[model samples]
Target: MNYITCSQGHKSTGGSNFCSTCGEPLQNSNHYLEPTLIGIQPGTRLRDRYIVREMLGQGGFGRTYIAEDTGRFNEKVAIKEFIPSVQGTGALNKAVELFQREAVTLYQLQHSQIPRFWEAFQENSRLFLVEDFIEGRTYESLLNERLRQGRCFSEPEITKLFQDLLPVLSYLHNQGVIHRDISPDNIILSGKTGLPILIDMGAVKQVTVNVATNLQTTSAPRGTSIGKVGYAPDEQIRLGIVAPNSDLYALAVTAIVLMTGKQPEQLLDQYTLTWKWDREINLSLLMTQVLNRMLAPRGDQRFQSADEILSFLGLRQTNPAYSTPNYSGNSTPIYQNPAYSTPNYSGNSAPIYQNPVYPTPNYSGNSAPSPVNNSGCGQIFDASIPVPQEIKGWNWGAFLFGAFWSVGNKVWIGLLCFIPYVGLIMAIILGIKGNEWAWKSRRWASIEAFKANQKTWAVVSLCLTGFVFVIVFLASLGGS
Candidate 1:
């Protein structure tokens, strides 16, 4: 999956002509090209069937690309190149075997949302998997577009989001599959069907993480987080343990972000370990209960399966209230509900869901480039020295305070805000790149320390923004 930065410094998935965040036209130069990491060049032929078109994106796991399959009349497909970080040819060959074996299960999975796995092959000492190419923007982009319009996702759309995606989850889970990484970036709104299609990474990310952990330098942190920092559950993050509910927990996090136009760090209370989003938006009591249960800190406390959630959504014919969904003429995509063909599962309760769709290495090459240095948001991020994914997202403090926020974070590049017109662009850049730049430039004791510093700035920025808004409103009223 490739990524391009828009005028607002928003990093959007590749293959999109417009900015997913700001909806601005993207220049070709803005399409991030890795100044390094030559995995495969364009026009390369593989298996005498698939021809490489261009590299889409890369990550700590591997790189993903778009290719033309000659066997299928040159239909475009996604190709993931897995280069394990481990040393030794014996280990590499064994890893390839595990990868091919895991690909078999993915081949068995047939669903409307999951991209079809074509085949896995090894050529020239490199491993590759061919998959269906989904043409559309990610849910992250869709939500960003909504935010650009001065609003967030409506309750109606979010309800339908669950309605549309839950079945896909049920299908995968019933097949004994668990999607450990589920976030808005991994779920794409298909251009063909307008349905949220899940593009899976399956064992690909597992292979990447396992290999790196064994080969990592002493400076590396203990234990690895497979899912995004905020979206993934605690067990998955702390213990590398995963279950069906892990995916559900992430789905709730995605919903909260889209529903309130706020990220996890902003919504969660570190001290109280509680969500503070009730005042942000008004949701039905039932919906709130579902989210809270799914977001339960402990895995055992949350719903265990997808069907349980479907049933709890008032899916029973006896309950017409939850049966008839509310439509508010909003542009959010709502699909035809799946028939209530319940699957055989033991536990019964409402569970949330999640999977990935970043444009760089999206299990099928679907995430943004993980920055390795003070890399510009528009530039290709290095995979070798990966940056922490936690700090990635909009920084309200950086956006509001402009150059002042830069001075505090020690991201001196942001000080260009002193210039008149450049100040506006600098502010946008700071908001997007501030956290990452600060992480790289300054010496923080830990990720927590770094986030703590920014969170305080974020609170202050919010208050200042609100104060300025009030003053402007009062002045307008007096003039009127």
Candidate 2:
């Protein structure tokens, strides 16, 4: 198949005359292709498996592409082409080694919101990292769409986003992974699940920068570093230092940008290192207080961990009956937990290092460790109120939708589906525990209302599952 990346980053596959995604001309005298990195071209095969489809986007970090993996039954993937802005063959080799090292760590991450990191390889004197391709618009794209409609994300929408995403962040931080980059462009809203999926690990970018700086002969290129100008914190940008809070700073900037439809430069005061975002728009005092602390110029002043942010937002799962402060975003929430105080991470400059090992695809009786510590869940359920026997059954919706369903219903355990190897087992567990978890977590009008909602979800999920099976059947017949 001949492929060419059109000006709009759309690929013309299947010998088409026009681009498949945007209807752009494949070979027109009038229009030219979008400016892409030199060397890597469309239709280029790498590692005898991945067929490059189009250059999705390029950045200071690296060039990203939409590719098809023939080995994975033609599954689409996002491949990052690591182009070190450095000189010398020795330096390039060092960079590749660094890239692989960081890639290994990224590959270990298994969170529902994070795209699965697949493989890291050196091909054609270039380094590439493969990841699951998300079929959705970036938050940046979504924000632009909203701006076009003469509005931006509302306070409540942004609040819900914070609620949805903070747990994912807590999961990453606990796993000793720092995204480094947490801007709107990096957060994609998955079309299939309608959940925000975090993409692009800046650890790769940081590795390139470290190689360039440490290796005396190999001078690092300006753009090869982790910090984005406005999104990055003072310590990250001015000094080469980062912590879990650094990501929180970027996330705050992203929220404000999405809410105000303004750039960080517009919101922040250059001299005082204070944000004037409130001048532009008025938000609830609680939200105002939260964003201010997150956007604080000093790293120590910001929320130390993503768990802290989740705590502040009252999103953590906790026992409702206990007068000892439980997790409830509604019904007079608890702002802080007595156990969770601001962590003093004064000495820790980078992600906490864990013993890295190759993942063996085996399931022990013990389930894969979840990213976020939601142990409070066990205590959340009341002993007196027994689960209704009438509605207790395997949940088709939970089984089918996985984390997508779990997230909506506040069943944190269902997110185990995002775990590296134990996801299938977790899906079955979700089906079994779905009804009980939902009953405890949320406040429904009545048991009837709860049953009705679950029933509706099951119906929709079954219909969608059937539709997918039919598509696969037709495709298999066509191939045969």
Candidate 3:
């Protein structure tokens, strides 16, 4: 009897229209639609390792397939085929080159939140990239499900999401990469961890190199605009200028969509170019401020980095040395009861400051102080209180070196030194209180090490300043 295999590779006894085991359509599975471009037939083995099962989806540049890794216990993987819709041999060659570049870049990324890149190869006159198959529903699907239930995501859910995904964005930014496409469809809520996994590297653009040289040598391919409409910011969609904040803008749009259960087009007014939300939703002012900054129309107006957002939310990177409170024997969790004070890890527990939004971890005397509590406070900085000890309160090094001091210590706020008037003001403020801000922004091994490091930066800045002065003086004398 002639048998038919389903998309999941389950073989039915006879040539039935539907799969016997999976119940998926024999001709076309409900999991994925048929490919529109060039693709491999189901059950075809490529590179003698990956067995293509079905086309997962297709885009302007390529088709993705659900494949099985024959070499690794028949584990499922996704294979991306580089088959751009552009015509001619030249276009195909360029497309292949771009595809290979993307694969190589992706291969180097070893983040837990990103898909694991397995291999990239050319077979049967086609290029393909293999990556770990994430078994989870897309955020798009989750949003749709919520909509069906007639309820949208709550404020706490959105806050938790931001906390989870911001680190992933921070990782990518630190690597000098920008994810040009960041929509709800590209995010997968992991079934195992319940954390968001960023997918679809097709739209990833390198920020450190000349992107035009690689992909837009002649003219950009017809499908070069890689982001979804409304989700992508104005700078990215119209000018093709994608910055780190561009992804944040898209993320903000995704959050709004999740909260409202409405499409981006519905929330945004095309004429005025601003977002609109129902007053009945009742989001806190802090969340409103954060989302507004993230969704700023201009990239410069938005928070430059994910870390900035985290700082605003009063969340800090957990120090590996510090362990969470042990709740082994207690039937009622200590964390659940607000009245219950955190047990002392050491003799000294820092004075507890309750944040209306998130639970603030009580640090012992041995551990570093937690991030500044900005939960109910509207101002970024208040002059009344002394700066936290973790960030050295005041230093002559920061005062003299100014922006240089901030940069050397990874106080990213120093980047604002490039701005005209605002930069001048920031430099002055950093000069006066740069050490305090830097300390709060980053973690240090010890106070002594941090002070020594700042002293060195001050010395360097002084020498550089003298050199510039001498050069200018010599030039002026020669001109006279």
Candidate 4:
């Protein structure tokens, strides 16, 4: 039997005109006739390293090929070719430039849940990117299989799925790169690790660049938006403005699709431009609320970050000290630890640092710190709580202001404010040693100068607390 490869690189034994797997035309006669539209043929060697096996898929922008890396123990790799359907040499040059620039960023990305980028090169007038070949089916295939079984994903399964995948999105956002297209089709479930791997970074279309350039020259609209319809938000589809929250919106839509076993278009109300999910889906109230927050039509109303969603799910603790590292260009990649230690508050003791000057007064190294109430006022006048008396220890101002406090006082611990509960912990520490931290972190000309600043911060904190109480009381009275 003669074997033929489909456009999706699936091998079929029967000699049919159309591929049995992907339903793509298998005959060379039916392929695009343009000389420029040809894909690298199977068995063709490029750069004396990669041997092309078959065309995986093609879109308006590029073609993906399954290839074998001869230099790397015959490891299979996915090679993407930049072949935009544009006629002019100028258009082709612009596309190649964009591809090259984006390739540099892609190559630097190193994550377990993402395909590792190997190399990028130009050969035979075509730009190509090589990355690790993920041996798994896309989420799209999994959804279809589940639907065939007459079942949709359960709430717990969807929650677990998002928990596993949200970190990948968080990692990407930390690198300042947004996965503009985050549909089920772009996510592949790793057969080896059983993890969802993000693919198709190329879906971030160059429409923004093209439009900006065109406006500078002729004020003409140029290039089409690059994203899957229904998955992408109105901001991205209409204005081409994408942010980390935009990916969250897509993730929420993916979850809804998996839960309902319906296409995004099917679940969405065309007129209202909102999801029309049936109310009887037996989902937990917490999960439902999280999904609603994530799917809020306005970007601002949506959960601002993946960390916030994780916190809402009770999977992660608030870390006030964690700062996501920038990974753009030549910057070193910062690895973030998802797990965090909860604050220890069980006995009358203070936290001792490595520095002897910052040692707690009665900490025996065995006794645990006394538990303090979360109520703002309880933390202030609780005499049973051991407060650090060091003049220059932890700053309450830094805790309340968080990153701003760190910047103001030149204390690095302020970065932890980015973590949810870390700020509260820092604030508690500051309540004990705010004056000390403020004094040490600043360059005051005199002790009096430091004392005055601390006094001011104390007054400010008190005023803010009272103001909050007044607002709450007024709102309660209005409700009554």
Q: Residues 376-396, candidate 1: write the lDDT tens digits.
A: 222123344346788778888
Instruction: Write one digit per residue (lDDT tens) for candidate 2, span 1-480.
Output: 445554333445544667677786555332223223474677877777888899988877678899999999999999988766664456666776667667667766777788998998864346789999999999999999989999999999888788778777766665556677899999999999887888887777765665556554343322223768899887667644556677899999999999999999988878656676766777764676578678765655566766667777777622122112122232211111101112222333322232112111222223432222111123234554456676689999999988888888877878889987798998888788788788665544346777888998899999999999999999999999
Candidate with the larger TM-score of 1 and 2: 2
Task: Tell how far residue 269 is off in model 4, in angstroms.
Answer: 1.5
The 10-residue segment of model 3 with minimum total lDDT is 332-341
Candidates ranked by lDDT = 2, 1, 3, 4
Off by over 4 Å in 1: 1-36, 215-224, 316-480
Which candidate tops TM-score? 2
Per-model TM-score versus the true fold: 0.57, 0.58, 0.57, 0.58
Task: Give lDDT for model 1.
Answer: 0.67
* True lDDT of residue 103, candidate 2: 67
Task: List the candidate 3 regions with Cα displacement exceeding 4 Å.
Answer: 1-38, 204-224, 278-280, 317-480
What's model 3's lDDT at 23?
85
Clashes of each: 24, 0, 1, 13
Q: lDDT by residue for model 4 over 1-480, one digit each (tens)?
A: 555544334555545676676777655432211224567788778777788899999887678999999999898999987654543445545555556656666765678888998887755345678999999999889989988999887888888787788877776766556677888888999999988889987332452245234323333333235567888878667755566677899999888888898888887778656565643254654676577667777665676668778887987522223335432343222211101111122233321111111111222223442321111111223344333342445445544555665566555665666778776776666555555544444434344555666666657766776899999999999999
In the predicted model 3, the residue pairs found to clash are: 391-439
In order, the Cα lDDT scores of the candidates are: 0.67, 0.68, 0.63, 0.62
Q: What is candidate 4's local distance difference test score?
A: 0.62
Give per-model CA RMSD: 21.7, 26.3, 19.3, 19.6
Q: Candidate 4, which segments miss by more than 4 Å at Cα?
A: 1-35, 202-224, 317-480
